[model samples]
Target: MLNIADTLYRWCREARPFALATVIEVSGSAPLPPGTALAVDTDGNAVGSISGGCVEGAVYELCEQVLESDETPVRASFGYSDDDAFAVGLTCGGELTVLVQRIDPTDQPHLANTLEQASDGVPLSVAQVVDGPPRLVGRTLSVLGGGSAYDGTLGSRRTDHTVADRVRALLRAGRTARVEVGGDADTCPEKLTLLVHTQAPQPRMLIFGAVDFAAALSQAGHFLGYRVTVCDARPVFATAERFPHADEVVADWPHRYLESAEVDARTVICVLTHDAKFDIPLLRSALGLPVGYVGAMGSRRTHEHRLERLREAGVPAEHLARLRSPIGLDLGAHTAEETAISITAEIIAHTNRGTGLPLSRVPGPIHGRVPADEAPAPSELLAV
Candidate 1:
């Protein structure tokens, strides 16, 4: 599993056969999402987690049994409402469908080759048939990025093509989902299925000023698993010593640097420089780019001024609407560290489509669903 890729590479290098268990589906408020995995070697060693802590003991023992029997590629379900007195289930309110499969290096050389990519950090999507007929279950199809050929197959050419198409689209969008095979577009959830898991390079978080807030926000961004970059026109301000957490510090003009930067659906940008020289040119392009988040640190007055300038420069109203001026959630933050927390909260809430409200106040899935109106204004994130 890509979650524990380095460990998998080491195991494969040692030719250690192991049993891999992955959560293929979840119902209710499971802490971990689908595609989370746990691995167990022949010696009963375990790596990674599936349900945080809810049903790990049972899943670990299941992995041990799968290793001993080697008759794996089996499915098991655990829930808190189980009637069996000695049943293993989640104490938290949720159910997990885990798929356990045996991976022997010598037995499945083709799969070992695929696992090797995990260590190299090459982007790829692995679609495994987690639910289907006995013959199709456990079958996997892998699609590697950079024009490389796909490895393995899901039984037939038609199935392979169908899964590959879905995987390619998901890879571009930096997403993963359960896809049905050998069914119409309106196929039910009970149909033959492939759990598609995508692995992309760490998404970019570009901070456009080497200020104190930038320093703290860069640390928060890195902690959130983004490859953070701090850029500024002033060489003295943009230095590794100043922004220790930034993956890269650039001393070029913010607009010029962003023009050449790699922008994707997962990229998020923060423009901390309120100066017109920096804000106007950089935001003119940033608001037009297809990034996940584009925010600016400023007061309401400054935001109004910035919007006016952007409008005068012929920036469309729709593009201006996408800009999250006065960056960060309205947490009444004062210090740079507090501001970083507010900003980071907004980023997380935006990414997950969260309500940015207290859990007690909200009555729905903890993990949010995509709303009909995909892009929400900064105020809409509050859900008042």
Candidate 2:
């Protein structure tokens, strides 16, 4: 899982034999989604979670069985309908398909390196055969970036090449899915199900003001698992002491710093510098980029003036539509901490395509299903 990458790396490096249970598929009102993992060691210790709390005891027992027995990877299904078959059932009426496998460091040495790369914010994907022959069930193959070279194998060389190509395509698109392979004439007639888990670097949140609200928002971003950066032209305010939660504090003009910053479609830019000199140039650049959210802090009157200035600066109408000048949601927040919460909530809502509406008013599952074509947005991975 994303939250336990570092811990998993440590366990792998220590050569500790552990059993890993990963949620490969979920439907209905499942608490967790695919790619979430739980690990159990020989000592009965565990890290991470698949279900919020329900079915954990049963999953832990299954992990223990994998570690103690000679069973191949086990595909366990739990749901309300399976109550008769499985004593452990989800109370939320959701169905979950999990793959439990014993991981030996000696057998899968590349697993440690994979975990280490993921922990260090390198994008990669791991494809594990979960269904088919018992000998192929636990086999894993990993592809880093868009490179053709892959580590490990899924039984035969032909199967490994096929899985690696699919994984590379998924990595390029930044998606995770369960794909079936090896049913064609060139390959084995028996199809095997492979659960591909794509691990992308954490999304970044760039706050271009070092005010008190910016400090609070930086901390909130950190809590939401964002690699936050606080930047400002004023050295005194942009010091790391002021924004200890930020991953980096830089004293530079917002536009100039962003000029060389690494950004992607999942990046969020918060322009808290209310001044025209700093806001206009920085926002002009931010609005043109393909970032997820761009918000600027200001009042209604200030928002209008900013719009006029942006229009005069030749920013397109569509680009202006991307900016949230009033910044946070309508929380009636006055304190910096409260404003931070409001802003963070808005960011989460935007990432999930939510209307910022109350859960009581919204229908269907509270968690939205992200489109497979899009990158794994921050809200999708957030353990809310």
Candidate 3:
């Protein structure tokens, strides 16, 4: 399949007017993820972000030039340390680069064809920067048909095909790798460079039992950019009006609801139904799945009781050990809103293999939430 980034680049190219921004580098803590992008128009409208609210205004100016000149793609850097850098600065002190390319009719044929493939749900790579040194920095590869085929360049046909095959494996398995190429004659690192990175879709959060807390949890999940699904046996409680922000509200037994779900290591299942009638069946259903986070909300006493019932239901002792009973990190969360934050925080920590500590202590991919929807249609994008 065409990676989301390639599809986005195509969308900008097809739009009447647009500019593309990419985070080419990073240092220190950053609010925006590397490979983050924002497509802008002549009027300073934008669809994505490179930083948490910093550098956008300046990026817009570059975008305006792209729209006006319609010339070669512009490589612009936004750094806190650059004396000539624009006035905008990241609150967290991280630096990034944004390449703004103005799309024109000359960019039409190739871009339009690629966008049509993307709209048809076919993914492929396109040559992004030509005439530059044959370095990995300028070479971009696109994967189509869900990584079945690759287009564009990673220096040479040999390098592109080789890295494409390996990256394709990682994409299917939903993992990222840091590949080194062309150092030696057999595996030379001097002739060519290729570092294939893939940003899989955002993980899902399936929350059972649409109680008052469900609304709060849905909001929390939204903040974390999870495709939140709220399911309950009662249709009355599971209305979209109650949890309007939820990506989906299903009126089905929690156990049966997840049977049709595409659960994976990226998926999280949280059981908020403290009653046995719900918890027992729910736990039974989840035990067979490969979900990364399986948490149940209850007290220590309730957890013990539920464990006994789960054991009676034949859930393996090893599987039962995976449950995070008395769910959520210890944040002294008493209210529904605070409790929701704590639960979502635990899910984040679980997914990242992170300790439940302040994010400031960690030095890793901070903005990890991938936009699940294909890069928003130009109209769907927001102003910077």
How far does residue 43 in candidate 2 sit from its true spot (Å)?
A: 35
Stretches of model 1 off by over 4 angstroms after superposition: 1-196, 368-384
Query: lDDT per prediction?
Result: 0.79, 0.83, 0.66
> Best by lDDT, which number?
2
lDDT of 1 by residue, 273-357 (tens): 9999999999999988978899999999999999999999999999999998899998989999999999989987776556677
TM-score, cand. 2: 0.53
Clash count, one per candidate? 0, 0, 13
How does each model score on TM-score? 0.55, 0.53, 0.50
lDDT of 3 at 220: 85
Regions of model 3 farther than 4 Å from truth: 1-136, 139-202, 359-384
Q: Which candidate order results from sorting by lDDT in descending order?
A: 2, 1, 3
Candidate 1, 244: how far from true, in Å? 0.8
Q: Write the per-residue lDDT of candidate 2 for residues 1-384, one digit (tens) a residue.
A: 555789888988999999999998999999998888999988998999999988999999999999999577888998875446345788788999999999888888888888898898787888878788787787778887433358997666666766776676566446778888777645545578888888766678999989999999999999887899999999988899999999999999999999999987668899998999999999999999988889999999999999999999999999999998699999989999999999988987776556576666544334322233443433544423
As for candidate 2, its clashing pairs are none
